[model samples]
Target: MNADGMRGGGRTLAAVDPAPEPPRVGPGAVLRQWFHGEHGVAPIVVGLVLVWVVLAAIAPDFLSAENLVNLTLQSVPVGVIALGVVLVLLVGQIDLSVGSVSGLAAAIVAVGTVTAGWPFALGVLVALACGMAVGLVYGVLSTRLGLPSFVITLAGLLFFAGVQLRVLGPLGSINLPFESWFVRAVQQGFLDPRVAWVLVAVWVLAYLGTQIWARERRRRAELSCVPWSQVVLRTGALALVLSATVGYLSTARGVGYSVVLFVVLVIIADVALRRTRWGRSVRAVGSDRRAALLSGVAVHRTVVSCFVACTTLAALGGILAAGRLGAANQGTGGADTYLTAIAAAVIGGTSLFGGRGSAWSALLGVLVIQSVANGLTLLDLDQATRFMVTGAVLLGAIIVDMLVRRRRQEA
Candidate 1:
């Protein structure tokens, strides 16, 4: 038994005997309560459902497959960006430069493909590399110069906007070179429908395998673990969503390349944050930077890695935007992209101040935001009304977060 770092508040840290359960709480009841808990994802989940129900009631076509597919596809860029933000949040940092970083990446890809006669694949890679470089520079500045991310990335927002304008130059936008076969392929391409089936199969197997392995590891460590039944139910539901989405989208546009990119980015971020030792260090540092330092975690390195994650994701998002739009320009990654990304992370229940979050939060949050946007369009809502609604959604999430925090304080 030890207090570790607990100061006097009449509470001391100490090991305790196993406390008996108050009673046998049913799994369903437990889950219900969990969903209502401060850290639970229930509020957002329920809000999403309520939005769908409201829209469906108002507009019969709101739930059409075509519209649904469009919604999912539209979610990609923001989700990709939010995926990066998740890493930054996990490590207790922020990156306002993602908007500009993504724009720069889009510009790089456009220049590489159209101006430099580069293959689309290679151009896209280079664009991502450039984004990583920018992120690394941001990390360096924040660490070495001791500047806050808010100010540093705020500067980046301005600098990258200027650079994007310079790249756009005389022409506002540049279509990729069709003279190059690869460039043509990049714009006018789609994945095979069968690929969706393959993806579903692979995801199911991988999820089950991971669940089993995790349970085994927890048992070996003599700690609480996700129950097998619960895992199966949760995994099954997720699989249904993924498979249905993929199958439907593949049928819609033969599978959007942007959607594929989103999935991969989410998977990679999840792995990086959950399965890596660096991730553990990041979580520790985020939860309590001073405690983590005492425990030998390198605070500077964790912060740097978070920026690396942010910039890298921003780059990937930029490429996706470029690919989906078929061009790049001064406004390549402007508008509500950054707002939506941050909003998604927040709605997905990531704490604004960090210390608790998961990479998959991006997917959940992005989908909710995009779905609302899509629904608004389907309902033919006016631009002003749409803006109001979007703001409300974000504000609602923030309010819920504050309430959750206050409740925790009371407890």
Candidate 2:
């Protein structure tokens, strides 16, 4: 008997032993697990619900369909910007110039199209290309020149702001044609009720399919898969919630195309971050750059790509903002814009310490910020009050993050 634990006979005892039974988990255990992590979405979700409840109590119209639809629309521009912030935060970096980049894009689009008589499409392309170029410069400085991101992006913020002023060329503002496709689409577009329902069904099916595929892969690998009961429960809950939301929103304008676009982007980002090799590298580098480099991650390339993505998204947000507002101005994307985006990303549970966050954070965080702003406006609160309240919320989120990090360390 070799070591006695496993015989070196015709067949070892280990080989003959049945695989251990998968642990049985009840609904209570499942709920606890879902809410267990510091970075989990469950907390923000609960918080959102409480905020909505409070606002609805104070102002009855706050829950009305029209108000909710407007809230969703109001969220898109900053929400898109916040989405990029999540990527940068996940990779343990910062870009203070997003607002400036966005403003420059808006100015370029407005001037190129309206002033230079260029086609709208050409102007948009140029703006995006400019964003890409800015990101490349930042990447080269941080990766090749060994400059800190904070300093590099701070300089970029000032530089781009100046460029934005120059691009506007003293007019300080330009208005798009009111009847143009861009303005109409942003201001008046809404999903058809039937189309919205179909999309919801597709989303649910896709989710169910993904879950099933994951479970099968785990089973094939001889790993413990989540029970089918849990899978079914989750799927049902998601379907019901989404269907209800669609139904409620349909009573007013249904979902806006802008909201749909934002959601699609979030879904894509979430998948890329969670499933792709590049996503894994980003997280690994964020956790520890030296360790990731030793493990053969292309840290420099990853950083460059993330910066490029961040700026590109910021430019897109600016374009959308221009469309929605029917004009571009010097004040189109200002300090408040970037500050709100960062605050939303942090409040939505993205760890400032890096390597821990989700694309969903952008969506939830923006919703929280927008909800607060909207609710305050409804209460006829002054801008000062809004600023103070937002600052308090941001501070609270930071404190929570620090406490969670310390707990992990002590553990």
Candidate 3:
């Protein structure tokens, strides 16, 4: 097979046969393919739209610019954690201890700065280093000692929770100074209106440039390239959506710096997964570890990198959460937090069976989850109702994933 064909076929072998080549046709056909293609985010986008419509009908203010802005901010911490979950899931591993790690980071930073007299930046760095250490240990256990990830993380989860409690001691909670830059940036920092617009423009332009560059490279290599018209169409649609969102948010506090950071992380992850050799090795390992080994991929190193990345991101997410909330407590990154992160990753369309997903899944999935939680809160629904509804949604996503996998295999 040609290199492109090999790459395409190698994307998902854990649960399904290789997908057949898509028919070469016109732009219209490609557009259709974009929507209905397996593993695309289009379905989740549609689901989010439906969710918004339903919630708006029930509570007219749910879509108000102010609430939407708040929603964006509220989604950031879990969204960041979910992004890490996507990486772990893509590599056919699980990290159930993310919540504990995040909570521990928050505790360390809180105590370090508030009690131990450490500088804020130093505290943050220490916390993140701890997270990386956790991941490194987990990776070694899984790769070297041959322990299953599920068990390793499960044990880590309990152990880290104990560590967090010990760090906090009898205080039970520690609050950061509200005026600290870390807290202010997460809680009160909004992009200037002009800057927001400029960011939108830059993103749109970068997207367009990327598409054109890719097409040119493919053409030069004698590979099939997407037509220019289709490229322009996608760019236009993205520009319109981003422009409209910024305009709406501009009416309120505009985009929060925390939101911007989360998005930048997502964009970086998407690019890495799509364009880097490390990413290719990750997918290859997830698709078939033995085959990837035979093909000369450094399977252990790749898995270790992913685990380290996952915990590091989780730590960062915890830092953001602490900043946003202005405190760290035993309940900071509780069971609900990690569960929500995992559910969001899956709901955003990352396959649990592995090797088929996207970085954007983290954003879309968290949006769905946070939107639901926000809408329910607005309606004064009880926590029980929110849990039931979110659980149902998660179950439905898993079912859909299995059905899609089965269909691909049959095809």
TM-score of each: 0.87, 0.92, 0.93
Worst 10 residues of 3 by lDDT: 1-10
Candidate 2 residue pairs that clash: none
Q: lDDT tens digits, residues 1-411, model 1?
A: 000111111322353856533332347644644554434666677777887888888877877777776776678877889988888877777877788889888888888778887877898788788787888888899878988888888898889878877877788688765555533434445578787688778888887777788678867876655556767776776688777767766655656666776778777766776668897887887789899989888888888978887988888888777766777877888876777788889888787776777776788788788877888887788778777888898898779767866775664
lDDT tens digits, residue span 164-268, model 3: 999999989999999899999999999999999999999999888877887788778767676677777778888998998999999999999999999999989
Model 1 misplaced stretches (Cα beyond 4 Å)? 1-25, 29-39, 178-190, 217-227, 247-251, 404-411
Residue 262 lDDT in candidate 2:
94
**lDDT against true structure, model 3:** 0.87
lDDT score, residue 202, model 1? 88
Q: What's the lDDT for candidate 1?
A: 0.75
Model 2: residues with Cα > 4 Å off, grouped in runs? 1-24, 402-411
Candidate 2 worst ten-residue window by lDDT: 1-10
For model 1, give the 10-residue run with minimal summed lDDT: 1-10
Residue 247 deviation, candidate 3, in Å?
Answer: 1.1
Top candidate when judged by TM-score against the true structure? 3
